[model samples]
Target: MTDIGYIHHEEHMRSSDLISDIVIGMSDGLTVPFALAAGLSGAVASSSLVVTAGIAEIVAGSIAMGLGGYLAGRTEADHYESERRREIAEVESVPEREKAEVREVFAGMGISPALQTAIADELAKDKVKWVDFMMKYELGLDEPDPNRATKSALTIGLSYVFGGLIPLSPYLLVSHPHEALLYSCIVTLICLFVFGYFKSQVTGQPPVSGAFKVMFIGALAASAAFGVARLFG
Candidate 1:
């Protein structure tokens, strides 16, 4: 039973974190570069320039996403560690107060006062477990593995490059620049809609609405960029 419980907990934690990372990585990788390509394709006449921009966007965007994810994850880990230390200090120095707070928290959640006191007593007996429990239940924080951050960043960045390629591939193969631009736009829009729908599913929102919202925003941005470029060109 204990082994089963541990396995379930570990699996849940890992799967949840993985889904979040994939969604974030794919979202950034696919949308921004696609938008950049779509907008630039309209303004530029040369296939060489379009290809150059697409390649640049993929490489630059991947690095940016990777670095950003790594730094963000590192910062979060640092903050969590700091807080955990603080929590330990408080538990050691002002144990009665912290215990009382824990009792109250449980009581407020409808645990009987007697049970809450008993639970708190048991928890306080094991200082490490008590601190961990407090962090999870009271503070709603889980200590993330430091290495996962780098892995997440690299995964996301790579995903972004892949997603970005979807929109740019048509332009690379087709000879007609105008047709390429149209096909790229179509592909990008379709991908965006799908991405938005999946994002909405993961986030518990209306899928169609979310899809439309992203599409509208991307369309607006692409249109604005195209208009500005044409005016300047």
Candidate 2:
């Protein structure tokens, strides 16, 4: 493969990590608001209440998701930087020890000592490549772009709000609670299935399985909320 092709392949694989964030946002947006609307429908029996609850859920949840994501991204960046600096220092101060460590890392992976030594020697000849390898293999970390994390958070938060709107739209547009709920359920399930299929594509899993998993979690969350509302209301 060409260099660009390999890079693209790697990027595609890395994109799977964002799926977790997307799923979290989507679940939060759809489940919480739908449950709130459902609960309000049960307690107040008003379409207005359902719509209001959904609006509140979307606004509050979006802000929370965005702020949470930003803070988390910042924290990860700081930690990565700190660890990278430490690795760099070790490489500078203890070249021999670092070389042995690298050799041992390879040896533990079933490579012969001689080959490991040669590989480490060649790798260590380039400081940037050596550091990059150590960070990835030894520390189990990849350098993340700061902008990417921020964008991820924003996308996730928006996705959540978007997903949530699916269940609430019927209530906003229709006056009948039962019909609204039914329509909401249908829309929510379709969205869940689509999201799951996309997630499966990213992770190389079965689309049906992922769809079911998403639906199951959304159902559980909404059900739990409904139960809580019943008990308290």
Candidate 3:
């Protein structure tokens, strides 16, 4: 009989940093412009004004959000690099102590004292690997991508623009703001529910509840804005 090899497979759904940026950008993009357009519809008769205002908001919002993402990414990368340099210095100055920390990490995993010492000694032979291993196990930091800042900025900015376009599209076609608002409301509400549902699924929350929550919040914000505009206009 021929020998057979067994393959093991595991599958899991995870939410990534990119997904988080998209959620932040898209959620605000969809809700903010939607609320603005709804409010303008209450105050004005011309769809042209609503479309113009919505476009302006989308441009400003995307830039502001992208800048925020870039700053956050930069801070994260900087923090990690600073910590890594400190770890390297510690490794050089107190080699024995650093080795002890390595053994401690293995010990925490239920490794035998002898095995821990053996593994730590082996790791200490290579300074770079030792420092990197310590960074991961002791400091709990993985190296951030060098281009994380630029990538985050672009992702958030583009996602915002894409989401912002949905509600504003109806206003471009309809001459009357009120008619455009009706179509915008229908389209945006559907999108909010769908977006929230998928967002919750990826993030491991209850999908239906999350969808309803998102939808309710969007409607309430727009309603409040519209009411205010109508009252004052």
Number of the top TM-score candidate: 3
lDDT (0-100) at residue 3 of candidate 3?
Answer: 47
Query: Model 2, which residues run further than 4 Å from truth?
Result: 1-15, 227-232
As for candidate 1, its clashing pairs are: 29-160
- If both were scored by lDDT, which would come out higher, candidate 1 or candidate 2? 2
- Give the winner by TM-score: 2 or 3: 3
Better of 1 and 3 by lDDT: 3
lDDT of 3 by residue, 55-125 (tens): 99999999999999999999999999999999999999999999999989988999999999999899989
* Ranking of candidates on TM-score, top first: 3, 1, 2
Number of the candidate with higher TM-score, 1 or 2: 1
lDDT by residue (161-193, candidate 2, tens digit) is 887888999998889776787788788878877
TM-score of 2: 0.82
TM-score of each: 0.86, 0.82, 0.93
Ranking by lDDT: 3, 2, 1
List the global CA lDDT of all models: 0.80, 0.81, 0.93
**Model 3 CA deviation exceeding 4 Å by range:** 1-8
Cα lDDT tens digits, model 1, 53-102, are: 88898999888888888888898899899989999999999999889989
lDDT of 2: 0.81
